[model samples]
Target: MNNHLLRAALDAAERGWHVFPLRPGSKRPALHGEERCPRTGECASGHRKWEERATTDPARIHRAWCGRPFNVGIATGPSGLLVIDLDMPKNNSSSDTPSGVTTFKALCERAGQRVPTTRTVRTASGGMHLYFTAPPGVRLTNTAGTLAPLVDTRAGGGYVVAPGSITPGGSYVVVDDRPVAPLPGWLCEALQGPRRTPQPGPVPLATSASRYAAAALRNETQAVATAADGTRNHTLLRAARALGRLIATGDLTRAEVEEALSRAAAGNATQPERYYDDVIRRGLDWSIAHNSPRRPA
Candidate 1:
């Protein structure tokens, strides 16, 4: 085993961060208990929820790092790290104004606060993981595209690749390497906003608008066809915009609908990455505007 990962693990432990050994070149755990093991039916390695095995114990850290050069993973909630993941455009675009940056700016405008400077990590894909200290009594859950398609969060049960970890794709490097800042009030409130949970008693019937919206979404997803190179973006945008309008009425959650849209867009002969920048992002933005709590008169 190379000393690099071992040294990184020890350093993380020294800093009081709960750490774990991810499989070499992969994010899955290196040591999974029997019941949840992925390698074999009998707990050889790779746990289902590997975050549970994370610890700050030096002895365990030594055992993991000593055996193999595993990638280091920091347990988010346990380590008090709330990460704001801003994924870059998939086309490998290096434009000064990327989709993630644009969306982040829009988010700040909506929230009325700027993101405080803190320890930021640049991921292998050129995206960013903005680290923040979780607030007391705030149980943040992992969410994808809740704020924007490219904006994700790593909270209580989530984990992030530590800065020193190397992967097959690339390395996770610290950009600022500064202390983690506190979760700003605006950002925290946005994350902790009221969720739509299933309540007891009879399930509310889907509204007519919602039913129509769902049917429209299903129809669009099923009808996705091969798109020509020039028309791919337009094709996906049309479908996503229609779905977004339905989503605006509370007919479906953004994640579920986006998944369907993604699968449909990836169908046949079309690539999903081609539509992310101009199609998917704009479609969702349209939905957010129409569905916002304060609807314009």
Candidate 2:
């Protein structure tokens, strides 16, 4: 990636993208002579004496893995650091359109609270990453996760923001709160509104929507399982799927779902069995509520 692309990745990171340091030799156009690890700060594996000069500096290592000019950083507040990733939509042009910009602006306005410097990181797929410094006492988990439907932090505190990924024309902006950009009251209200929870109510499991929900639950089960093994990709994917299922079903109580999810993550029991139990219990409850004959006085 070029400087522009690197800057884009930075912007995306700021917006809560799960930025990972690429390993060397994984470069598409293989690094010719020498290489180094981006994270470990070590010489590239199996370097010959002739290749020493080619692979020593951090910049070269980053270039080798990233194949671009960028690094990922999170907004570490007085509390902790937040790692993020951008999940861009399939269409790339969405970022450059008016609606895209408006959405991006709205998200920044909502998150712009006592932030200072903003930096942009470019991504491999012609996108941008944005970063901003958080203020004292503000927690990344508190702000990033609660700001869902707009942004979310996965299990390990990484977030994936929409419309800001490598999708055509997708871009991110790091707004410095210290400068105090004028923001709409409604945007603030949306950001400050109480967090929404999954509603526990009777739902028609036989409908098309319920079928989709069941599939989603299965996907979530797989994701959680993969995450248990310490794989980043599956963990993030599972979290997203699970969140979608919760939104779609609207039948399982949030508390129950959360408890089930927590148990699944613990990996003490077989996930599929546990998941089946939870879903079946939910269905049984729904049936009891909907099908039971009314009591006569």
Candidate 3:
């Protein structure tokens, strides 16, 4: 790696961040060039490819190329770094929403922690990247899979929040001086343990039904005007409640609940004009299905 890039990575390490050097050949194809290898001009390794030189000597190549920016290296400061990639949801309706950032902030708030920087590493698409430095001796694997859904790891086209890896040219922004906190003990402990078989929790049937009914009412109101007092609405609402109860108690996964809701709404469609009703039905179904069982009154 370039001395500067390597130094930056080391600096990050000193600050308690984990560092991973980008492979010499990992850059996009267009960036490749016939530069002399750092090891040897005739050497097979770390030569000829722009990405290879960039990876091997990020600072030099970055200054020389001045075209494509460098990917950031993870800093292995006193604390290990937590790298996160922000991704856009596939659905166009919700595509513009800042769900990734919202989710990240929400989780951090819930866990009583904060990210280290607001500087975002922009993706090829217009998504933001955030980074956090964990306390000393903290391990990333401790929360790997559990936190997987919340952030992209860049292993499969997603970008990781690292140094030199994020440059301003590709719509990337690197925020600095943000506060970061240690991961919560409960979350760390839970993540460290083996995945446990999901269990059904005791949920009150009536409460589940009520929550489902409310969710259905909300969906119907959003999709259609006032709901007519009728058997169809009542039946749909009942199904929603049942699904909600299953969801709240961990009896059904989110995917299973969504599928059930889709099926339920499909059966309830009365007219082509009310196609949106199907969407509402599905949403309500999911809402109810995921409702947690109520505690004893």
Candidate 4:
């Protein structure tokens, strides 16, 4: 057994990340298969999958890596991690294929936000993984293309091969040593989505500026709710853009507008909430930028 592999496993465990062994030079788990389970040890109760068997126990780490130079795999869900995968396109020969890094930067620009700086890993295949701690009380699942093309996230029910793992392609290595950052609130909002709850009923209001804005919101919310299947995202964007004016002028808060639009769009949603979220966020950002408050004339 390679001492380096053992050390790597120990290092990950010390950081409080639950880890399991991967087959040497591969991403697949090295743990026993249920079909061939001896029905002993950890599986005595039942066959625990690799995720369940993952541990931060030093003794377990040493014992597991003693027989072979197994690669390390981090169970992101158990570790409270959300890793954003920024990938290089497989067919790099095509100019049209954008790298994950590029698309994610464009997404940040669209949201009028900066790309977060955090601990990062360079994958064996030359991709980047930005590590973040998931917010408390929010359990997110693995996502594919929820952010942008060639980008994915690993959270609950997904795992990431730890740095020091090697494969035929190359070795995973840490590029940034910074501590993992908390998942951004905007991102959490995008992935977790608006809480599913009963919609509020109509209430009478005075004919004021806020009332007009509220009426517009109600009308556009209805438009989005009744949008045709093929036009849901488009309708969501338009509605958000219209409501953003109220958000900018203090007639409404961005939070309320977001909640309103998200709730309205949820009924007609065909794509993942993240996709609709991206649409609404983009529209609101555009409106805010173009309709910034002016100084007294």
Candidate 5:
């Protein structure tokens, strides 16, 4: 038995952080999945997820860790922790792309603030996790590249591996052992700002607006027709915007563009017909507003 790991689990629970077991030398949870559930003991009622089973009880912690030297997994949601993960770039050779730490520091500078001192953990991969108490009544969820490149947040329905966990890559260790700080005001404001929606890309034209409008139309609409489930709406919206730009130059009528886009997007659109219409309407509206009306001479 690894006494060090056992102590680590107990220490996290002492801080009221809900704890669960992760597989030894790995970040994945050790909990049984729903498919493997036997409908007995903990699963008698139903399958309990790792988050639901996470506990702060010392006795349970001792019992779970006594047999194997399991790594610790903390349920950030139940613990009321919002962990900002500053990650390193996957391709280390890329000098042009900035790491999350660099971007996050720049963000703090822009907000006229400094990065808050908190209980920070250095992960096995050398990334840093800044632990903060989430604001009451605000349930933030996980994000991918939401703040900047290689930056992510773990909240409601997310988990983080605690310090003292070791993986094949390296060891998770405490770099700065300061007390977990409250979520900073600047970050809270940033999080609450207007959610940014995805915008369409640059307009497409193979040649002259009049001569190439039909070719452009065929290409864009064809893209929407073959778009798969998750990307279908985005494809439709982009096509609409590109075509709407042609409408602005009087190369294509709005009626024909709308009908062609709608027909192309019908089967593969993720939502109802009304949703497709709204996306098309907004995409076209945005393109028209940004472009000046002109008749091709």
Candidate 6:
């Protein structure tokens, strides 16, 4: 067992993140297969989904790394994580900006906000993984280039190569030290697309109040980030309403939530401050009308 990989896996487990082994130098899950395994000749077992093999148990992790040093793979769904993958532009087009970075900036601007600097990992390809916790009851699916060109996501059923993991290109390096923030409602809805509504489930308590606020703002940023110009206001208003539910929980005050959301809305120059204020006020109003003072039974 490589002491480095063992330490990394143990650290991740300590943080409550589930992990698994990837082939020594590849992102593919290290599974046994009999058929010809392209990535690693050691595999004799058939193809396997990484999610199914991921685990939080310390013993299992120990077993996986006891003999060979493997790349660390973090399962996103079980770990309550939502990862924004920003890939560098493939070609040197007219613009210097990578499409992913441009699109991500556009998303934040549309939401009138700034993307939270949370736990970030720089990929070997000079890309980045923006780690955020998934909101209670929200299950985002894995996506590629759907949010914008070169922007991908690792949600439920997806696995992100961990920070300490090494690859042929380079190592996945952590760029930020902040804790993972929550996934905001706006971003959640946008990533969800026009698909079926997520079934109602228990809302998990957030790690902290500040993280909760960051999560809410992240959603607002996403909402604005992906929405078209003409419908931006309506989209923001809708996002404000979703945020209202968070305010209703009593962990966050109205002003605090509004301020966070306003920052996300600030990116849009055309929408006056008063417009965002009005939208926020209305959203809060809806929460006040519907939310009970007591927590749900």
* Clash count list over all predictions: 0, 38, 45, 0, 0, 15
User: Deviation in angstroms for 127 in model 5?
Assistant: 1.0
Q: How many angstroms is residue 43 displaced in model 4 relative to the true structure, after the best TM-score fit?
A: 0.6
Expressed as tens digits, the lDDT of each residue in 119-225 for candidate 1 is 89889878888999999887898988787768999988998888878877798888898988998887887887754322222222344445576567667665444
Comparison by lDDT, 2 against 6, better one: 6
Best of the two (5, 6) by TM-score? 5
Question: Which stretches of candidate 2 lie above 4 Å from their native place?
Answer: 1-21, 24-88, 92-100, 106-117, 142-156, 159-297
Residue-wise C-alpha lDDT for candidate 6, range 169-243, written one tens digit per residue:
899898887888777667888898875322222223343556766566566656654566688778777877777
Compared with the true structure, the alpha-carbon lDDT of candidate 1 equals: 0.74
Tens digits of per-residue lDDT, candidate 3, 1-297, equal 355444554444455443344433242333324553355553455454321222333344345334332344443232344445655555654555555656666666776776435435555445565554444554444232255344543221122434444333343344554654443554445345653322222222233345554454345323222223354455555555655555556554445444444444443445452553455466556666466555699
Whose TM-score is higher: candidate 1's or candidate 2's? 1
Could you estimate the TM-score for every candidate? 0.58, 0.26, 0.35, 0.68, 0.64, 0.59
List, residue by residue over 194-281, the lDDT tens digit for candidate 4. Answer: 5554443443333344668888878988888778768777888888888888778877777777777777777666788888788889
Residue 282 lDDT in model 2? 58
For residue 290, what is the lDDT in candidate 6?
A: 81
Flag the better candidate by lDDT, 3 or 4: 4
**Top-lDDT candidate index:** 4
Q: Residue 288, candidate 3: how far off, in angstroms?
A: 49
Give the lowest summed-lDDT range of ten residues in model 1: 196-205
Extract clashing residue pairs from model 5: none
What ranking emerges by lDDT with the best candidate at the front? Answer: 4, 5, 6, 1, 3, 2
The residue-by-residue lDDT of candidate 5 on 165-270, one tens digit each, is 8899898899999899999977876776654333323334434557588878888978887876688888988988998888888888887787777777764555
Q: Model 4: clashing residue pairs? A: none
